[model samples]
Target chain A: MSINEIQDSIIEDFSMYEDWADKYEFIIELGKELPAMNELYKIEENLIKGCQSRVWLHAHEEEGVLKFQADSDAIITKGIIGLLIKVFSGHTAQEIANTDIYFLKEIGLQEHLSPTRANGLVSMVKQIKNYAIAFNLKS
Target chain B: MGAITTGLNVQAIREDFPILKTLVHNKPLVYFDNAASTQKPKIVLDTEYHYYSSQYANIHRGVHYLSQIGTELYEKTRHIVKDFIGANSEREIIFTKGTTNSINLLAYSWSSAFLKPGDEILITGMEHHSNIVPWQLACQRHGATLKVVPLQEDGSINIDEVKNMISEKTRLFSFTYVSNALGTINPVKEMTAIAHQAGAHVLIDAAQAIQHIAINVQELNCDFLAFSGHKIYGPTGTGILYGKEALLDAMPPFEGGGDMIKDVKFEQTSFNELPFKFEAGTPNIAGTIALGTAIEYVEKIGLDNIFAYEEELLKYGTEQLQQINGLTIYGNSIHKSSVLSFLLDGAHPYDVGVILDHLGIAIRTGHHCTQPIMDYFCIPGTCRASIAFYNTKEEIDLLVTGIQRASKMLL
Candidate 1:
């Protein structure tokens, strides 16, 4: 599926929520379903700074396709990271690098997140893009 | 004033702050982050509006009617602040941007003149970055050393260690009156005496203490005291740096500009007198004026009553928070303010803060700009619920419920 298609599905899923409580419940559910990262890969070097929550993101290029795995101590942060991973992972480094995930705003996630959490979301996106850039250079 | 009756009409007080009436996430807003900043009372807002709408003019420089009125109102705020902090004279109050700005002023103006190459500046382990970074910069600039007074487990500084730390080489000692993150109230009066005995000038960072406790600079006997306006229900970008008149007079001007100068010539320029010497350029006139009203509002409510009511709230909050099975409260100081910093077992502070936000609760989670304290505690950060007098028992009960919900969702 295209990145837009995945984002649309997420948005449709989110639209079912009537209030912030329900929306956060959905996000927490998403967090529970996220694929866990390797404990060894959760090093200081892989940790994204500036997040109130500790987020560890690991990316490696396999056959010119960048695959990303991430984890966060915070459930909401993890859920957001999972969304970013779904959009950016398993794609060419070039394609991932060129992508801008406007789906957060389209899905009203940006508006939903508190100001500080919004900052964390931005940091998560930056870290993902940074990984893509590093892999793109290696390719 | 002796301990007044706790006749604090919290409902009426809540009415004074319009923000308290608003909804957050479809629930009644529960503001427990008073340490970050406070909601302005209607009077403070009205004062600012009144100044801009009716009493607008440039202060000090103008000889006209509006200017004269503005100058009087602005200068009158200095008097209110001077009396508020129990400083000797109005010359002691110097308006700066905030506590950070006030500290930087002292660091630059005072340290540049006094600090010699081997001199030491001492601060405590629990200081906010504002109190720490300025001295670090000053020491780096002047070839001086920055020393730290160690903290006890409950987060109070060891007074004996502070005495031992101060010596002939220690030229300046600055510390916070209250820990912003941990809520430990330090013994500033004794610390000031120790610094004085060691022949070191002292500066008290009252940014956290100003709202919760009554401050008397004379009683504390500190040479310099700094606090921000916003923390005390006043406007942002406005704060006070109360220095000893002799010290302020002797120290060079912090920033040289139009208002801060006596005469401007091509070859050389002389400086303005005490407070104006520090207050350069177009100041935050509206903010300064509004701060006077905030002081009056606090006075009207009576600091004694506020303190009593908040003490009761603190007791209730502490007892209730302790009941949470996995919740660990930081800073178990016997003497502390209305701040409650805690960590839920196996749950990140960020996640806790986010879930609380969804429940219409406002809290501060993170290092709280005091990374060194976080380092001391060996934790990333904490979820802090710093209460104000306006907060109620019911709101705290709601916070407890929110935390339970968050713990179940996150943990």
Candidate 2:
């Protein structure tokens, strides 16, 4: 599926929930189902230090496609990372760099990406984009 | 239900703060972040509005009628703050931006006037960054050494350590009256006495204590005390740095500006007298006047009554939170204020904070600018629910429910 298509499906799935609690429960489930990153990858270099939580993001390229793995001590941030990986992981670096992600606002979780929120989700997205740009330059 | 408990009409008090009626995400707002800042009462808001609308002018330098009124109201706040903290005289109260500004002013002025090479400035491990950073900068500027009194397992400072640390070289012993991260209320009087015996001047960071505890600088015999106005339901950009007349007289001016000078010749300048000497530049006139109104409002209710009611709320909150399984509370000192810092077994504080935010509960997460406390505890941070007198038992019950729901969702 395309990045926009996945974001649309996720937004549609979120629209079914009428309450904030229900939406959060869905996010919690996503967080729990996310594949755990390797312990070796969770090093100081991959760490994104935020005021409220810690996040680790690792990226690599498979053929021409960019793959990403990330985790956060915060479950909400982790679930949001899961959503980001779903949208950006399978795409080529060039395609990932050009894609404009707006699904967070539609799902009422845009606050998590605000710089003031300081949960590392903003940096996480920025790191993904930077990774994509670096890989694009190499290619 | 409107109820009166512990001689404080908390229901009416809650009504005075209009924000308490606000709804967050379709639920009633439950504000438990009093330690960060308190919600303003209607009177404080109205006073600020009224000042801006009716009586607004630059103070002290104006001979006009409006300026006179503004000056009177602004200086009235200085007197009120002097009385509020039980300082010796109104001249002892020097208005700064806030607690941080007050501390920085003291650190710069006092260290320049007193500190020598190899002199020591003592602080604690549990101090807010405001209290710690300023002294560090002072020590750096003056070639002085900074010392810290470590925290015990229960988050309280050891008196023996304080005794051992203070020596003839200890120039200033500064510490917080209450820990903002952990709610440990230190023995300020005893500590002040200990520092005095070593001929070290004591500066109390009452930013966390001024609202919850009754303070008397003369009785405590501390040379300097600092507190922010906003923390005590007053306006931001308004605070007091109460210093003994002799000490304030001995120190140099912090900032060289318009109002701080007596006469600026081409080659030389004479400084102004106490209070105005330290208060450089144009001050926050409207905010200062409104701060007086806030102090009057608190005085009308009485700090003793507010303290009593809040203590009950703290006890109730501690008891209720203690019942939750897999939860651990920090700062188990016998003397505590209305702050509860805790962590769940397997959930991060940020995760729990987000879940609680959805439930219309406002809590503080993270190290609360006291990273040393977090390092000592070997945790990233804890979710803190600090209370005010306006908060009720019902609100606490809602908080407990929200925390339990968060634990169920996150853990």
Candidate 3:
């Protein structure tokens, strides 16, 4: 699927919820379904540092498409990361680098998140972009 | 549970705080983050609005009608703050941005002049980062040593350790009057005496204590006391650093700018006297006036009344929260204030805070800017419920319910 299509699907999925409670419940459920990262990839080098909740994101290029796995100690953060992963993973590094991810704000995720969570979101996006840049350099 | 005489019409008092009536997530807002910052009363908001609308001007600069009125109101706050903290004179109170700024000012100004190589600055383990980092920087700059007064198991500083630590080389002893993270009310009065006996100066970070307790710099006999306005129902970016007049007069000015100077030549600049020399800028004129009203608002409520009322809330909160299975409270200091720092078993503090936030129960989570204390306690962070006088038993009950809900959901 295209980036825009995936994001639109995510937005549509979130908009199905009537209230914040339902939205959060859905997010938590998504977090539970996120594929677990290998424990070896959970080292400090792979960890995103700025998040209030500890999150580890690992990326590697598979046949010119970027694949990612992540986990978080906090369920909400895990859910948020899961959402990010669903959008950005399985895409070309170039597409991931250039794409503007507005689905968080489109789905009111930014407005719902606390300041710290918002910071965590920003950090997560930056790490993804950094990974894309690294892959671009290697290629 | 035993109750103390507060002599406050708390329901009427709540009416004065417009934010207290606010609803969040379909629930009445239960704000228990007073140590982070207190909600402003309507009187403070009105005072600021009135000042900006009519009485706005650059203070201590212009001779115009508005400037004079602004100067009077702004200077009046100095006198008000002096009386609020029971300082000997208004000259001792130098307004700064906040507690962090105040501490930084002291670190730069006082330490530069007084500290030397091998001299020690003693702070405690439970100190907020604001209290710790400034001294660390100062020590680094001056080639001085920094010492820490270790905490007892109950999170209170061991006074004997402090006495043992303060020696001929101990130049400054700085500590918090109350731990914002732990809520342990340190024995400042006794500690001040000990520091003074060792011929060392003392600085008390009263950011957590000023709103809950009566502060008399003269009575505590501390050389310096720092507190922020926002923590006590005033505007942010405004605070006071109360220094002994002699000490302030001797130290070099922290920053030099207009209003802090008597006259400036191309080469030589003669500095202004106490308070103004340290203040150094166009000052937060509106914020200062608003802080005056905030002090008056709290004074009218009376610190004794606030103390009694908040202590009751603390006690009630402690008892109720203790009933939760696998919940552990930090800082069992016998003389604590209105802070309750706790953790639920098998649950992260961020998860608990998120659950509480959804329930419209505001609390502070994470390290509370005192990472060393978290390290000492062998925890990453805690969910801290810090109360103000406006909080009620009902709110405490909601917090208990919220915690239970969070525990059930997360664990």
Interface CA RMSD, all predictions: 1.5, 0.8, 1.8
DockQ (Cα-based) per candidate? 0.70, 0.87, 0.50
User: Clash number for model 2?
Assistant: 0
lDDT of each: 0.88, 0.92, 0.89
Model 2 agreement with the true structure over B177-286: per-residue lDDT tens digits: 99999999999999999999999999999998988988889999999999998999988999889999999999999999999999999899999999899988999888
Candidate ranking (lDDT, best to worst): 2, 3, 1
Segments of candidate 2 deviating more than 4 angstroms: B1-5
lDDT of 1 by residue, B232-344 (tens): 99999999999999998889888888799999999999988888899889999999999999998998888888888998888889988999879999999999898999999
Number of the top-ranking candidate, with DockQ as the measure: 2
Name the TM-score of candidate 2: 0.98
TM-score for each model: 0.95, 0.98, 0.95
- Which regions of candidate 3 are displaced past 4 Å? A112-119, B1-5
lDDT digits (tens) for residues A1-139 of candidate 3: 9888999999888778887767777777787788888999999988765435677888888888999988887777788889889899999988999999889888767743445453255677788998898888888
- The worst-scoring run of ten residues by lDDT in candidate 3 chain B lies at B1-10
- Select the stronger candidate by lDDT from 1 and 2: 2
Model 3: chain B TM-score relative to the native chain B: 0.98
> Whose TM-score is greatest here?
2
- Kindly report which residue pairs in candidate 3 clash with one another: none
Q: What value does DockQ give for candidate 2?
A: 0.87
Output the number of the lDDT-best candidate. Answer: 2
lDDT of 2 by residue, A18-133 (tens): 88888888898899989999999999999999888899999999977999999998888899989999999989888889999899999999999999999998898999999999
